[model samples]
Target: MATTGITPSQDDRSVAELVRQFSEQTSHLIRDEMRLAQAEMSRKAKHAGAGMGLFGGAGLLAFFGVGALVTCAIAALSLELEVWAAALIVAGALFLLAGVVAMLGRGQTKQASPKPERTVENVKRDVGELKERHR
Candidate 1:
């Protein structure tokens, strides 16, 4: 009879080696995926920070805008009313503008909250399953 030299022990060892290699490859892939997620998260955080900064600038501009409006109001009232009454009216209008801006800023901040990433969640699930299977 013709002889084939494959042994059962050798075949089992080869299978184990293949599984170990596959596990290592999967782990490396997960690491790569995690790195990508972190990069994306950092980019998003930067963008959010920039947006917040812009909002702050806008808030500052709004303050100045309120000042301009008050100045205009005072100028208008100074034509007919007493100086103190004109200043009081301008102050009231500035307060109202400040309240509206505050509300708008609050809404924008609420909208800026970070959302969960699906890729990170999937990677976590995959790692958990792999660990459970190896055990």
Candidate 2:
């Protein structure tokens, strides 16, 4: 029979020795699994961070694009009126749109309550039921 010195023959090992070996192997396996999970989460977080940065860059570019389009609008309006008048008209319209949006947003904000009303009510009901059960 050929014996590899790397490991003991299981058949010759006492039960207590085998149990100790099993406990060590299980602990090692759990530690390895934990390390793998940590590595995977780190990799995912890096990818998500990169994705968020790209999204921010995209939003900036889109904002610049909108500025260009607004400039084009002013240029088109200038053909029918003085350049100063065209610019003022566009600026005024933008302010008017902003005002309308702000008013709408204010109305929406007023309707939004800080409390989680439904959840609170449910919890109160649950507590009442629990008290009744105890009695």
| Top-lDDT candidate index | 2
Q: What TM-score against the true fold does each predicted structure earn?
A: 0.56, 0.72
Model 1 has an lDDT value of 0.90
Model 1: per-residue Cα lDDT at residue 18: 92
Tens digits of per-residue lDDT for model 2 on 71-129? 99899999999999999999999999999999999999999999999999999999999
Per-model CA lDDT versus the true structure: 0.90, 0.95
Q: Candidate 2 regions off by >4 Å?
A: 1-34
Instruction: Count backbone overlaps in model 1.
Output: 0
Model 2 lDDT, full chain set: 0.95
What TM-score quantifies how close candidate 2 is to the native fold? Answer: 0.72
Instruction: Give every collision pair in model 1.
Output: none
Query: Every model's Cα RMSD, please?
Result: 10.6, 6.0
